[model samples]
Target chain A: MSQFAPPVVKIEGITKVFGQGETAVHALRGVSLEIEQGEFVAIMGASGSGKTTLMNILGCLDIPTEGDYWIRNLNVADLDEEQLSVVRSQLIGFVFQSFNLIPRTSAAQNVELPLAYQGVSLSERRKRALAALESVGLGDRGRHEPQELSGGQQQRVAIARALVTNPAMVLADEPTGALDTQSTKEILELLHKINAMGSTVIVITHEEEVARAARRMIRLRDGQVVEDTKWVA
Target chain B: MGGLGLREVWRFAARGITANRMRSSLTVLGVLIGVSSVIVLTAVGNGSALAVKQGIEKLGTNSILVMSSGGAGRFSRSSNSNAKGLTIADAKALNDPATAPDVKMAAPILNASGTCTYGNLSSTPQNITGTWASYFEASNSPIDKGYYWSNDDVVAGRPVVIIGTTVATDLFGTDSPLNEVIRCKGQSVTVVGVMKSKGSTGGFQDADSIVIAPITFVQRSMSGYGSLSQIQVEATNASTTTAAMDEVTTIMSAQHKIKAGANADYRVLNQASILASSTTSSHTLTVLLAAIAAISLLVGGIGITNIMLVSVTERTREIGIRKAIGAPKSAILTQFLIEAMLLSLMGGISGVALGVGISHFTVLGVKPVVSLTSVLLAFIVSALVGLIFGGWPANRAASLRPIEALRYE
Candidate 1:
């Protein structure tokens, strides 16, 4: 962690257990990590290695069973569901393997959804959504629905949605998992472009090629972090 | 924009409905059928009640009829030659201002059924009344031609008759019945006047088929002389009909000479009181029919709830996506609730249109009367039903965890 810049995400011995006693499964076991502002990091793990659990924790979709999780100096572990939602809106953006665009809605509307939750004015939302789409190289396709777009284009729309709120961090789970090799490459390059634009980006993936595109990589095994490494790409 | 407004919520709800056209339409159809039935049934109830009121009015809003019921002091010689029931004496007593000050005119009615013949035509008259000349004035039966029996005709027991329009048509056809001679119940009577037509009065009695003659002539010819069945008394106005009824009762009781606590042999039927009581009962019936029809609304509400619950489950992933993108529970709740409201509102509006159209065509013997209060009440209630029935499913959708929902297939 750098001394000058506060970490966008800070974790300290966070643990998550799925159920109580006898049948209980520890999905995240006392894992700790810090990611600074504007860093591009990849989390690598095999199946059942708690990668998704950790990602869910970081995204504030679920509360940890133990320990502290701070985003932008606020203790997320201490926050309620409502406050967590606000924090998630203001600080984190999420992208999934399926793209997750509302099926019948246009690309611009998908991007504008987060702002709608924030209660933005209509014209302003339209402007920001269009700008976000333009930044993701889908400027002309804002009115196109998801089904009308290719897999790569859909992922790009999902990326635009993530960045639309100008969040502190973007969390992606197997974002390129459903894409062809060329689309996968394109998605990774977009993430690089996003990270370079000074927003923190974190990706969860099992593919080595996808992980290598990030400046740092962390691997999980048996619900515990087994390796953490830094690299220049 | 951090949260949804009313317009945005509505738009979102509309989109959700449009997305699943078949399901949404089926839910709306349920509510439509319910609301339309409510409107139509209530209208029918109201219409029938109004018809009954008008019939009573046509019967004469200020008229009261006193009839003997074979109790104490029966005076009619037709019932018992020795025993006394209602008679022409009692009718004259009721007509006297000193005995019944509220009574405008009291006409004694002696009933008979008779076959009347004019030339080759012969038909049974529905009403053969033995009454004085005052009967036409008291009963509001206008004279279309000739005249009623004069005091000379009654005193001499002359067989002169005043025929109603139906009797006139049956016996005289297009020819004038004035001064024509017709045989009634084998008694030859001259038709002195023709009573004007009093159209159908709906289930009470037909007034146009009557043949009225001098009470003396009717009593002597049709039954034992001096026998009478009823006295129809008209009050000065509608407001005093009850007072007029009480006055008639007191005079009759005195004429019968029954003790203070004993029941009188006669009964008085007051038109205003009957109208009021019938109105109350029919109002109750209308409400009952409306309540029964409201059950369909409840069933339709349940249909909306069921469909909404299924929709929430089907769109689990969509909910997850919305939640993950920072939608609060209130937003999700609002979305689903608005969709439910829209479903019922659409159904309600269309149902009202259809109901009004159906009522305008007039069903049954009465014209259906659609009241504005009922239409507005039905509409508002339908919207409330959406909110009420949609509550549980909307809460369920809002309560779903984003992570679990995202993972749902």
Candidate 2:
């Protein structure tokens, strides 16, 4: 990676408040962070530590109340809801804790969802979806629905979905929270392999073991960054 | 925003609907009932209207009738006190070419009910109308068998009669009644002609259960010859029927010494006016039936809205998944809207089939005539019902925030 390249994500004094007046709850209070390209980072926080809220902001699913947030040098605050959706489709990928695969849909179709939203032709989407499934070691299970697949296999399909668009970064919100220990190990290894291939990966977790798998760790306490540490290979 | 293609939108909607087969089918049945009722009820109304119009047209479009309003006692001159009854003089006046140029022919009539017998087979006709031979042309009664008696037979007061198909069937049982002598009102009358069948009108009056004879003979034997019962007039053409009616009215009013716009003792009725009034009434009935059916369609639309609302609630997480993956609001909206439209459209098509199929058979003694306009209108209205009622639920699904929707259990 070039040293002068711009960071993938940059946020300055980002605040998110719910409700108004005296009853308003401050979900995020003046948080500042930057994430460079090809970096593997883990954001750690306890429940109510605003990690989820921050993940939402970074994924462009939400807007900050009082801050300037940029994605690849583009100001996100100026974009409308439609543009934000486009940014989500083309620029970012999300992995939910519960492996949010659409019910009654095949694994290949689930992986092709983002491309479908981007208006890719049917033949091209099918080809790319099959390739993505193959990359996740489930090429033969392309036609299997989420209900038929195990937790680890479903998580692999989700990771394939997250990488199908070749997004700038992948944001995982407790991706291993709903899996067994063995499934969690497999998912963490998959994330590591994706990072080793020069793709940016961000993992959000409350577990110390999951944090240790990433090269860098940022801890949040009461909506503020309490610790930032980097581990050299 | 670039989003799912139209084909994909429709595919998603189809899948969504098929996911809940029971509820979707029930919703479709609701719309089906509404649309079918609209078609069937309107068909019945139109059928009855057509029956009435045919009845009026059978009396000859250019024919007019003048009848006395002086009550039933006009048959006996001594019982009638103040009101003057119509007489043969009024008929002669309307027949005069100099005074009533539009009148082609006018015949005075005397009506009586009598038991007719031929060789011990007796049948009582609904009415025995006594008039000139010109009555045959004015009333559109063609001869199915023998010939009609002429005006000379009327002047001579000959006992000559023409029987209708019903009376012929009852008396002869398929045999020809021509040149046979029948006893009518204790008088022997020779059967000269048999009129063609005109069928029953609106299932109330039998146009074929009638017998016609010379007016002079009827007055002399059956009625007392006090006053004429009715005068049947024929106009030169259909266009001159109103002029003919006016001329008959003017002559009758002058003969009865009735001033202009005063209460005349006689009433003039023309086929055109009866047809117009009947048509207007039937149109009103058709509209009323259609309006009643529309209410059911509206209820069906509400059923769609109710089901769609439930669907949105059930599929909140699915919508969130799609939205989080970058599905545009329009995609969500189109998906739900297409689902609703598919339901109503299927109902509309099947309803048309059911309604048209039912209309082929007679219902409640009335043959239903399906109007094309009603069918098209019903189908179009059903589609519109889906669009209008589906809008609210679709918007609700579309406007839901991704985070809140995903958070919903």
Candidate 3:
């Protein structure tokens, strides 16, 4: 692929350090990567390999200690807190391992939260939220709260929330970590369907089965990338 | 899309509050109690103050009274009595415009307690006021029937009397006391007129339980004495009462042959002075109660602060989620502040209703006059309390980093 196409996400020599002095912990040491538009990528690592820190920086939730991060050709590393939040809302959607849907809020309302923060009118927000819920095949459960849904269905609602704003990319952190094998397979399949429909997706997982679902896989160890491979399907 | 609109933030706050119904209601209740007490106490205070003022006004705004004081009246009946006290001559001097220019009318009052009887009914000690006919108009007491004893009656020491309504009822019942003869103080006197019912003055004195006659009749026929009790002076107008009192003091000093620096045997009490003293005491009481009410409001503010801090800590995850979804710090701060303000505003409204209801329905010791100013003050103070108290917690919530808040568990 030509670099001139401008990858959706680009990072070079990014480092994240926590604390200072003798007790300093280097979470990400000189990490570099590029993700093209509409790409389905998986980052695999054990708990101490700093994959979560990389995910945090990529989602714009935290800034790197050093190095440049570009998302959609905008310098993410240099952006202010307010600018970072806009980038997070307009460019990246997050799916956590715990689903993270507000407990008492209905699935549709949860999906509408990002749009509401974006200052969308009430009617437009409701319409978009319902449409996103329908796309996740939970059209009949629009008013159902997270507690009332099954694990796999809650994950679907979260994915709907993630896609409600039509973000440039969706970042999933252990998306199926808390699910049973059947639900996990269903969630992975849903992600695959989303990817097939031209949405870029990044999955962070320690499980090989989850990583295998993506065409491009990067393995991390000791806060550094050790293997980068792409399968020729 | 750049920032959250105030409308959106408000809706979000409403949703958040409703999601935890108990907590919101409890917080609202705190503010309600504070505001209601403030309004109610102020109403009661205002009502009592008005009542006192009206009572003092009923005593006649243009009247001044001169009475014996400093134990001078104690030796009035003794043979070796030296204190001149208040005398008929003093009243006569005060009535002279050249001597006391502001004095419009002066009446010599010789008060005596007498028993009145007619047919088979009798009254307990009825007060006998002996004065000129002008005393009726000066004291704001008007005769309802017949006529007051005239100057001719005073000159002749006539056996005629003007009885109050209560005394009239006691002596004659349904019968007309117009010309009926009533026995008083073992002397027979014809009822020449009936004074109108002057219910009560200064809250305690029964104005209608009296018999009015000529000062000469009181001194000669009733008391069998030659001493005067007090002098009641009426100024030309309400504004001239102090001037009238001063002129009366000067004339009385010369009449009694007293030096300028010496304390006169009698004290001149003006209506304005009495009104001012009463008003000041009532105002002080109102201020004390208002202070207590303000303290209650302060306690309410503390309650708001306590709950808001807890809410900030409890909603850490929610704050993190909002931050993640592009809610700016200003948005989060506004969201929480609007929530606090709404709670207090609603509380203030309900408190006003509650206060007005209580004031109208219940029988407070005072009349409970609900002024618009008091209600507005209570409302504004409640909102200020919300803002001042909610600021700290909202700031804490806004300053939280998304990663740290999200990881707060």
Best by lDDT: 2
Which ranges in model 1 have alpha carbons more than 4 Å from their true place?
A1-6, A19-23, B1-3, B71-83, B119-121, B143-156, B165-179, B192-201
Please give the distance, in angstroms, between residue A164's alpha carbon in candidate 1 and its true position after superposition: 1.2
Clashing pairs in 3: none
Could you tell me how far off, in angstroms, the CA of residue A70 lies in candidate 3 after the best superposition? Answer: 4.2
Task: Sort the predicted structures by lDDT, highest score first.
Answer: 2, 1, 3
lDDT of each: 0.87, 0.88, 0.84
Residues B1-409 of candidate 3: C-alpha lDDT, one tens digit per residue: 3335665666667876786889888888888988998888888888888888887787689989887754433245463355576777888888898888899999888888878898789975457878887787778778899987789888898989999899988878878899999888888989999988876554667778998888888888766566577788899998887788889888888987879798667788987888899889989978887888888888888888888888888889888877876677777888888877887887888988888887784346677888899899999988888898988888899889998888987
DockQ of candidates 1 onward, in order?
Answer: 0.65, 0.55, 0.45
Off by over 4 Å in 2: A1-6, A17-26, A63-66, A73-75, A196-198, B1-3, B69-84, B97-101, B117-123, B169-180, B247-264
Index of the highest-TM-score prediction = 1
Give the per-residue lDDT of model 1 (tens digit) for B82-201. 346777888899889987788999998888887899888987877788888777777877788886678788888899989888888887788898888889899899988988887776
Q: Could you give the DockQ of candidate 3?
A: 0.45
CAPRI quality of model 2? medium
TM-score attained by chain A of model 1? 0.97
Per-residue lDDT tens digits of candidate 1, residues A70-172? 9978988678888878887778899999999988888998998899898888889899999999998999999899999999999999999999999999999
Q: Please report the TM-score between candidate 3 and the true structure.
A: 0.87
